[model samples]
Target: MALTLTCERQGGNYGPACAFSEILALAERRWHEWFSQAPAMGGPYRDQYYYAWWVLANNLVAPFGQLRHEALVPSKKQYIGVWNW
Candidate 1:
């Protein structure tokens, strides 16, 4: 997912290989911890998605220029939903 995001950035280009698995793993762990503590959310993975975005935003420090053409820009809207929680 990290690789996909970077690739979706403007004028980004994918490398021969990238190390994004760790990011996804970390995101999953964070989501589990969050939901386990916040049972009111009543998961079906909604909280997980939001938490994943939060983790990505907080940790992904790579520049847009370093991403692949298919990579996505981190949009304000994308960050709003999770951060509000």
Candidate 2:
């Protein structure tokens, strides 16, 4: 039930090892909870779950964003690239 991720850079000194699979499972659970609790798009929940998904996708390269780091740029850019838009 604890939702947490270790800073990879911190290594073993931080705490127990967190597998990538665990992260994926927790992310899916959180997503499902949001989907179920959230109202349909353009409805009262418009500003809730839908916005949450958008933020998650854009920030973490979720499928909804349709943009990946590979297409963005090798180096950080001041603005989002065409692929991201």
Candidate 3:
């Protein structure tokens, strides 16, 4: 069994529709691009290093509402808002 889901905030306008496979491919390409820019880290912990980066990237949010700049939250599942410290 398998499940796949995509979420988007349309605000008011619904953007052009995209096939699920296309969306997945685009996401994969984006992940590759992001990983390429990351600092190179190698060793037995290479996978762990990338996983940490993935977590950070996944939690990133664009400037929205009161946020004036892009930000990263500790955990999207636990944090509902961003705070500047």
In order, what is each prediction's RMSD in angstroms?
10.0, 10.9, 4.0
What local lDDT does model 3 show for residue 79?
Answer: 67
Predictions in order: lDDT? 0.52, 0.56, 0.79
- Spell out the clash pairs found in candidate 2: none
Question: Taking the tens digit of each residue's C-alpha lDDT, what string does model 1 give over 1-85?
Answer: 3534332424555555435786577668877785566435446987787776555545434444554333333454545322121
Output the number of the lDDT-best candidate.
3
Better of 1 and 2 by TM-score: 2
What 10-residue stretch in candidate 2 is worst by lDDT?
A: 68-77
TM-scores, all candidates, are 0.29, 0.36, 0.66
Candidate 1 residue 19 C-alpha distance from true site, Å: 1.7
lDDT tens digits by residue: candidate 2, 1-85? 8966653433336565778898789878877886677556776767776766655444443233364542322223375534443
Clashes of each: 12, 0, 0
Which stretches of model 2 miss by more than 4 angstroms? 1-14, 42-53, 56-85
Q: Which clashing pairs does model 3 show? A: none
Q: List where candidate 1 sits over 4 angstroms from the true fold.
A: 1-18, 40-85
